[model samples]
Target: MGDELIEKAQELKTMIQNSAEYQKYDSCRHILKEDEELYRKVNEFRKKNFEFQTEGSAENGQADRLAEAYADVLGQKAVMEYMNAELILCRKLQEIYGLLVGDLEFDLDFLQ
Candidate 1:
């Protein structure tokens, strides 16, 4: 399941990397939509894992530890790492978009 999610992330990353729309302001809104979806999934996973931890604590410390470790590996931190990477890519694309559209005042660093 983790592998599948990672694979999906990679696929989305590739799509963004290759998209001409990702290179233009006219489609910046679309890229934001994709980012929003990714963030939504990350938040959903975090919430579900938190709920799991809350509901399963009575099982044993072993299970709780395992879940916590798994969440650490697959939850908010991992998602944030991916988002940081994507932010770099998006910044590059936004640079091109700004140059082409002549809106040089926008800052991409805020996305970080």
Candidate 2:
């Protein structure tokens, strides 16, 4: 049964890879990679964003600076398009994940 589930998951992965959203995201990623400077900037922003999100801390001006940097990065048309495509792909993946796991049974009343 576990093997069957793994096989089905692989099929779902292949289907996602064939999706338009994934194609666009992949294309934009390749384009970003072609530009060294832009790729560096994007990676830096993404790292900071991820760190901030995970830390859940907004020091005096940290949040503002991050927001400003975000605006600056997204102000570029290519970056904006890439981000949009990425967001679309992520949302699709999230929806699929929710549908797959939303019905699973779990006992977690301890935290409450």
Candidate 3:
């Protein structure tokens, strides 16, 4: 059963890889990987953006500042294209997960 599951998972992975969204994301990722400086900048921007999201404040509108900074980072062509493609792929994966989780209908109200 485990072997069969593994085979099915591999096939699913191959299908995803062949998808147009994944192909575009993979191509942009490869381009990003080739540019060390741009890649580092993009990562740094993403890190800070995530930080603001996970630990934001309403005192001085820190989220607003972070959003502006993120826009600036995204102004870079390579970063923008890669990020857009990456998000496309992520959303596609999320949709699949959502469908599976909805089908499972696990009762998690007690976990709260």
Q: Between prediction 1 and prediction 2, which has the larger lDDT?
A: 2
Clashing pairs in 2: none
Off by over 4 Å in 1: 1-40, 43-76, 103-112
Tens digit of lDDT per residue, candidate 2, span 3-102? Answer: 9999999999999999999999999999878889888898888788778777876665676788796787768878888989999999999999899999
How far off is residue 98 in model 1, in Å? 0.5
* Alpha-carbon shift of residue 12 in model 3 (angstroms): 0.8
Error of 1 at 5 (Å): 36
Candidate number with the higher lDDT (1 or 3): 3
Off by over 4 Å in 3: 56-60, 70-72
lDDT of each: 0.59, 0.87, 0.83
TM-score of each: 0.28, 0.86, 0.80
Clashing pairs in 1: none
